[model samples]
Target: MSVSEREKSYEWQVEDARAGQRVDKFVTAQGEWSRSLVQSWIAEKRVTVNARAVKANYRLQRGDRVALRVPPPEHLAVTPEEIPLDIVYEDADIVVVNKPRGMVVHPAPGHHTGTLVHALLAHCGNLSTINGVYRPGIVHRIDKDTSGLLVAAKNDSAHASLASQLSAHTVERSYTAIVHGDMGHERGTVDAPIGRNPNQRQEMAVVRKNGKRAVTHFVVREKFKGYTLVDCRLETGRTHQIRVHMAFIGHPLVGDPKYGPKKNRFSIQGQALHARTLGFTHPRTGEEMTFEAPLPQDMVDILNRLRRESGL
Candidate 1:
């Protein structure tokens, strides 16, 4: 491989849930590459497990570190669209947007356009390339059905700083969610580890072994007959962390399709969750910053209806 391709190397530590899975399958599950491509890389001895080149069918063991030196991408086009963005804050270093529900943060399979990244390309023109061409300037992501405040870096320095803050667990991120069961207590914390569900590769779950540490502190803001509005603060960000943690505690978000019950009472799409608050330090100025976004109309309407039904 070329030096530039070597510089693009990626690594992932195998968790307990992924133990015994084929190396090619494990690498392909990352969503960045295809199985055939991964197999080709393995044949070329570009993929390694624990510093040793492995075959495509090599079964990964817990704690094994997998590394792959990927070739350059094949002209994946991400066209800039004229989609409107709800700008909450903007400066030379960063742009904060209030992304509405149903709008994807970045492009992926089956969601090529109408994404926040496409809109940002048109609005800002220049963004940090740290996350590569597909997710330029994106530091973090909320699910497609989630609405909230998210920041994007305009330059590499800004992206590095924001990413460091997130890794250090210093960024302040809080969300509002309506859960299915009424909470018996006013506040509590769910401290668990999250990892990919072994049975269902596409889903995340609270796992007892080899999972990354995830903590969520929540307080009941309001309660209805069978639901509770709660505030959730994330200590460590994981994919589907809040949804998985809430469901682990037996109070999954009202409209959550993956983690919650199959049937839902609310007509809203996806989870009844909104990222309401975000705080971080400015990369250039070393200044503290925070932003808040109100709940979307659909969530507000549901709360209002719940209050009326409960006579509260």
Candidate 2:
């Protein structure tokens, strides 16, 4: 791999140690840029593997050459709007938020405003930039249709700590979801590799090759004749772990638009999934903490109806 003599161009020849790592991750580790920045660079076609364009999630192999052409930074601005936020916990280092359903974590191509980031910006004025400008303070994310708990880093150190915990799979996350089928097993684990859906560009699918390892452990919390309430614990945070895994196992969530049926008896806006609990070690004090968010009104109301109908 060679660097251009004039501009801010960088290249790397992948080694054994770097093999199997995401290209964006490997490049970011070589420099001080945030993952979001690297991902943006990758998305803008500024990065390439062996002269071929690759997605950010592309896994590198030994002997692969990666090159990055840096253009002068074009500041992508995100305005802070006066959106109401549900602040669950806050301190000097972190902000724990109970995100409502329909609220996005950050700005994306189609979703550029009215996000949790905007609310956080209005509430705190500053957030950790490790995830870059669009995703300040965001340590992790929940789908726009899934409501529940998320933690944001107010500073860089906290962001690093939280990110490390996630990488190590030490952070605990739990979700409550209503699925369409009655699971045969009371508890089970879905260990599969998840990659971008080949058929649908906007979806994820389980693939034997070119997919990241994902594991989800779930327990049947309650059961009805045709539905089940499951508690899911993720071993890896893929884009759509619970939703995809459940659908893969023939038990899609009640109102999932992407992975489930077109119509359901429940007239909910989106998926019947909620991030109910989150646990992690305090970045500052080294103390362990766990937080739980009560089921939202829609979930509560649906459960009530299910109980009444099923006589449970």
Candidate 3:
């Protein structure tokens, strides 16, 4: 693939404040490019420093001329919809919202509307376009069924900062889940490698080869006669990471459609997993902040039922 013929080129002159910074990283922070995307452009020779093709790591001097050509996004026409959103916090840099169960984060293959992006577009029109046409402000993704607090970047700088924190494994994310079986230990860790399932192409599994390393630390919060409530801490953010890892440990989350048991015990809509706590440094201020969201009504109702019927 190549840059589109109608590439939009951005020009920047490095100032004293940005002198000595790496060219790719400097451009990434300037609100138009992502770090990885900038690096890719540098490799493609679409980025030039001082009228010369330079490496991604090239340091910029004051008044250095930088030109970058980026492909224009497809006019997918993701219209703004005035869907009600559970806004927890909002600022110029970021907005934190509690996504309810059953709402898609962004446009999938065929589906485009009714997603969090659509709502965000209506709520906050100015969103970071780093993620592309569909996922404008999305920094990370929670499953369609798992309800939780998620943060979105309003600008590219904030997006880059948050993405950097996630990559460094410094972001804190915790979840509460009701697993199918009684966990043997009070606390445990599942250290495994997860990759796309070889058998089922749509699913993820603990594949030995070509799998990314994943780890989940769990603590038994409350135990019942047959089920267990556990708090899970994620160290890696792979697709379906918590669900796949918990299932690997023989205690899949209850109501998990793709990974749970076939027999019906709980008439839950989706996985009994809730993202409870999320923590990260502020993109603009560098302040460490954490937020938590309570369990949804469905999960709460099920837990109450379980407590009354089978107390442990």
TM-score: which candidate is best? 2
Per-residue lDDT of candidate 1, residues 179-229 (tens digit): 988899999999999999998999999888768899999999999999999
The estimated TM-scores of all candidates read 0.79, 0.83, 0.82
lDDT of 3 by residue, 1-312 (tens): 345537788899999999999998887776545566778779999889888999988999999999987876656468999999999889999999999989999999867779999999999988887888788989999999999999999998898899989878999999999988888999988989999999999999999999999999999998877888999999998999999998998998899999988765776778999999999999999898999999988888888888997953
Model 2 — TM-score against the truth?
Answer: 0.83
Q: How do the residues 1-312 of candidate 2 rate in per-residue lDDT, one tens digit apiece?
A: 234324488899999989999998998777646677789889999999999999998999999999998765334378888988888899999999999999888999889889999889989888887676788888899999999999999888898889878878999999999999789999999999999998897999998878999999999999987889999999999999899999999999989999999987776889999999999999999999999999999988888899999998
lDDT of 2: 0.90
TM-score of 3: 0.82
Compared with the true structure, the alpha-carbon lDDT of candidate 1 equals 0.89
Candidate 3 lDDT: 0.89
- Clash pairs (backbone) in predicted model 1: none
- lDDT of each prediction vs. the true structure? 0.89, 0.90, 0.89
Clashes of each: 0, 0, 0
Tell me, what's the RMSD of every candidate? 6.9, 4.8, 5.7
Candidate order by decreasing lDDT = 2, 1, 3
